[model samples]
Target: MSDSPDDSGALHLKHVLAAAGVTDLTDVFAIRHTAKNDGLPDLWTASPEAVLAYTREQDSRFRVFPENPPRSWLVFMDDGSHEGAHRSRFYGAYENDGEALSERTELNRSFHIKASPLLAAMKNRLVVEWTAPRRWHRRGTLAGDFRVLEIADPQVIPFVGYDKVRLTYQRLKAIVDDPHYSRWHSALSAVKGIYLISDTSNGKQYVGKADGGGGILGRWSAYAHNGHGWNKELAALPKGQCEHFIFSILRVFGPEAIQRQVDEAEGHFKEALLTRGKFGYNAN
Candidate 1:
């Protein structure tokens, strides 16, 4: 019964119910199922309140409540790291509205089915996660399989991976445009650094310094706007092709450092990154 849904009309929820040893799918308590879907671009990127608003669109009558709870539960998996693959797995769902289910905050949350048979079975086979996309729809009390939808892979999970961003010219735009990505933008803005921009097309590197009032974010903003950021050597190539540029932090400098020191550090990275001859894009 752990098999994923096939093109056939096989219901995944039925499989879950069977695994949970539930026979009749009667007055099943309908829980909200809000998952990442195609119709909304920034669905996962939204703030918690925004997400709550999106999920609360369902009719109040169908929403899950402690007093009018469902005897069973179900879900709809639209997209995830599974690459549109769907299968029942260990999950944890919670609501902090002082009602829905548990009032425990993210900092003090744990998923364990301490109750006997039925509740314990629900806990083991239940989908638990904060990623649901809709409030519990009371109408969907019947066990049903989730529909797997295709979406662009490598989904962007906010606050998950930012420190590792090797700034590309395109990604630079996101950093400037999206406040959610402001953590890196703010950190980079407060420091000085020697950065490396690699012309991924030719493997050429451009070593630059950002120690002025603007800091690294200021320097990168230029590249995001004008690819190559007015680098003489990069100017020789076509403009549209600058999309191949890759940026990354080479070295950071303390505020106490002077312009001359930053220039020296930039010089060091220029040599290290070999932006000189072997695809060296820096004319200077």
Candidate 2:
């Protein structure tokens, strides 16, 4: 093992990999996977199997590399710790077979990757600031200059609390569907709440209620499945438009809370946010 952190207390990515016996930096590449509205689950909260599946199925359509694709891959999960500077947690390393596939192919190119143990111990423990914030993927030779933000303890992003709840549509779906997010499911299912959905594309807001027996989880599950939970205005959105919607809670009620009180809370938010106005998405 080598000293991962340097004199300036900054650990360079190249130095870390070099310490891990990755002698051939030219054959390697790095990818920073971020949460998106794209039907894919958030890798940060996804199961280990799901993570591996995503890493192996490097779809050729997105055009990550036009030529000179590397054989070894360094996967990282986009840690949304900052807005401008791109910080990512090292996921793992994988070495693929030496089969070159055409980048123009639209089909999914499944790489036969044998999990590399080179950086196994450092997974999730290593944080690096990606130099190219705009580019999701880059050649390893070019990415070696990334500054290691930390090599601290493994990060555990918990389902902190209901008051702090905020999620994109993609993350909402993951919490509902993925078994890995059962803690989130338990918390959300225990409360009835007035939720807000904001369409980031047009800056429109929708205040909705989740007073069902299944609580907020049940209400949002519908939106997770269909992008719109049968709401008149939400259903009218153009295809894929609802992906821009973000979900958050405004108020919560216990299971025994009166139905009328929940209704009043929902009405209160609608009036305050002016969701029924032209700038909003609420139809009523």
Which number leads on TM-score?
2
CA lDDT, every prediction? 0.51, 0.78
Q: Model 2, range 131-223, lDDT digits (tens) per residue? A: 767888878777787888878554333453676577888888877888766667888899999999989898999999999878999999999
Q: What lDDT tens digits, residue by residue, belong to model 1 across residues 67-139?
A: 3434333322222334334323222223222233353343332222211234333332343221233433433
Full-model lDDT, candidate 1: 0.51
Q: How accurate is candidate 2 locally (lDDT)?
A: 0.78
Report RMSD (Å) for each prediction in the order shown: 17.3, 8.9
